[model samples]
Target: MLIINIHPTETAWSFVDDTASTCSIHHYSKPIPMETIRQESRILYLISPGQNDLQLAPEEQRTVSQQAPHIQTIFRDCLRANPRADHRLLSENRFYQNLPPLSTRYALPADLATRFQRAGRDALTHQWAWIKAKSILPEVKSLISIHLNSAPNAVAIKNGQPVDLSAGFSQMDGLPGFHSCGEIDPSLCLTLSEKGEPPAAIEHLLAAQSGLSSVSPELASFSQIFEQPESLASKVLSHQLKKTIGGMASALNALEAIVFSGEITPALTAWLVDLLEPLTAFGFIPTSTISCESITRLNSPASRIQVFLMEDTPWKIAYEMFSQAQPLQS
Candidate 1:
């Protein structure tokens, strides 16, 4: 099976053969020749992060592709590269067959970070965290998983499936990311535009120059913020994260677990869980300090809710989810 994950900044492709041999390219440096893939009879799946959660009709697909031309071009080239190979659009119920599409009354916009709210980015960042959260606390009925990364977002899982997300019409709507201002008043954007700031310039500022990094120019990433917990940037991020988690928790009547994932080191996990200890209602009191490991259990055995820290790469998680959802013959 071959899976290609598409993102705004980069593209990644992975090939897993019958023997489970895996080879991959994770940057936009070079393109994979379709002829190599067509040499064997195999399935090729093209995936765009949050798009998998939406069920679109044939016409809707065309509309969405038009809005996201980069994605559309990739799909077109892949199709032409291997005209006879089995190609799948791996979206909506096509992947994660057990999980239903999120329920919402509003019509979803195109999958662009700038135009409207979309999960394509969040799906890449949070889907794996959601899967890891469920695996760690398999029996929890209601759960909230927080992903702190370059493009951070939170997911509310009920009955072991995603039911809600913090991301709004765009990746910029949810929790503030490393550099992007998560949620802000719409009037502020208009105010900037009226001041003669071009739309592209405004986007670059909000999506690239704001958020945690804005608090302290020296702190460029979440990793750095966690490293210097006493820094102004770290303190500001801590305050914001606590508030975001609290708001998400309110949406669920009965919360059982809180899992932390994405671009975190073991020290960051322990530090974050300790900072969030005030939310006693969700059982975050650790019997002892969490160990600095890739995966750690932070809660005590007697707590009403379980707290955990697990780390896994997004690409690995996405490939696993897709492979499991639609297994192909060797």
Candidate 2:
């Protein structure tokens, strides 16, 4: 089987042998023959982020560069609400999992989530069209399907489902985002609004202009903060990541391995490991580092848990999804 991953940032295609392992891999360029897809039994696994899983008709395949105001309206609705939690709960449970519900995250309204999904429909369809234009294959076009799986950075398969997600979702209740503020005190939103700060203004500030950039003038982007390790931006990011990973592990009740795949994650590895190892008390350090032209595992002997460095997680998950799905009758 041939697995081609078209991610938001990079693209890679791999040939898988009988053992279901990648045999040969090509990166950032198309090396395979276009006729090969039509001539052989193959599947194309696309990992276009922020795209819906529903396949669209060819006529509906145009992408939108600007998000409609309505979408942001729905996003802003998820921001903050009237204050509710008492100070006692906040003070007593400074530890993760025990922190007040309003501290790190909020329950996103279902209708609002759906609205966001609907708004991105055209964008996802446009992505499929873009991939097809480059490949020039008609036979396997229908084979392209959406993997409902999502995650912040990498793709994780749990309970037979993909866990990929866009920003503003609360998977990382404790993890602060780059420009968007990290998890915050929910009531803070209410207080800000009371002082004449509109809900929309707060949302824009958090989503567009906060986090690392809000902290200091020098750190405007993740790359900027990445370069300035001793700076305050790096310090806060490190703290937030550590807390979030620990909280997630605790909530899930298991911690066996870590896979890092995303636009920025693979690049921020050494820094992430330093932050992860201290809080994690596990003893199963990786005995050897794994690497390949295609897929590989990173992590030195002292680091615990098998660490996989996938070129593209969505593509991997999409392949698994397509392979697992029952074919439809003609």
Candidate 3:
């Protein structure tokens, strides 16, 4: 089995150099040895092999084509030149066709496009297209995995055991992903969509346009505002920060139990605890310790907590309880 490690920054070919007759030298980069390569070979890994992760605009395309001519050229050359070689290129950006019907470019505002044009272009999109088009090997299955700042809601669980969807979903529920809103108001979505807005626009509003941006107009980032002194806005900001931390902690705990197991080191546990500290301070449910326990307890065959958590019933009770508990503060 040929194992190829394609990084996001550079493309490196790894194969037994059969050309060398005396002792076949393993033709892998000095930076990454052949032994390390073997360790990561249980699952197939593909990378886009680009410098940075940045979405480019239409105008910046020309400059990128000029500067990173070799990136795309190498990709095309690799698939075309070496058809038999088993390799996968990892990318940060999604690719779409440039010509007529095939092309449905990212729908963004003109101002955003102009800003992106000023920034340097990303070679990921181009590399993705080239790989998809040329690589037609029957053995190679095209698997695309995107790593976001947040945790994923779904993950493929691979073991000697049979493939199970229930197991995957159960593992996924604890994780906070980029796409998931993490305790969203279904009524808000229904109300917004009822007004005849497009589904795509609603999706963008929920995913990209909401959160910290919606809350703070003056501040560009949540971290910047988080540094400010206590105020009504700061309190709200604190709450948001706490909630985010809780979600992240829950995700890490779930991942540890289902995937990492003994591999879950002290550093990882520390990171998870650190994330949950703010949430604990804010009186949000302690996520790190009770996350898995809560999932198990709430999802039991005979449990009322599941219904409460699922349908926002507990939120009402919590609000009332808080109101009664701290009347003077309220």
All candidates in order of TM-score, best leading: 1, 2, 3
lDDT of 3 by residue, 119-193 (tens): 112223222222322232222222111111232221111121111111011111222223324335458778888
| Tens digit of per-residue lDDT, candidate 1, span 1-330 | 676766545667777666655776555556667676566455445455443324344456457656776766766776676666656555433323333334222354445322332343344435555566667666767777777677666777676556666666555666777788877898999999999999999988888888878878887657887888888877776777787667667767666777777554765875776676787655656756556576677777887777777665654555556544443222
| TM-score of every candidate relative to the true structure | 0.75, 0.49, 0.29
Give each model's clash number.
7, 9, 6
| Global lDDT of each candidate | 0.64, 0.41, 0.31
**Residue 303 shift from truth in candidate 2, angstroms:** 6.4
lDDT of 3: 0.31
Model 2: runs farther than 4 Å from truth? 1-174, 263-267, 284-296, 300-304, 313-321, 325-330
TM-score of 3: 0.29
Clashing pairs in 1: 50-119, 50-120, 52-92, 116-169, 117-169, 117-170, 118-169
How do the candidates rank by lDDT, highest first? 1, 2, 3
Instruction: Give the per-residue lDDT digits (tens) of candidate 2, residues 1-330.
Output: 555554434556666554556655678443345454443354444334333322222223334213234323312321211112110101100111122223223255754433322112212222322233224322221111111111222222223222222123322222455666756777888999989999779888766676666676676566655566778877876675555445445543555455444333433544545555663467545424333423344555465454443344333443444433333211
lDDT of 1 at 150: 71
On a 0 to 100 scale, what is the lDDT of residue 283 in model 3?
38
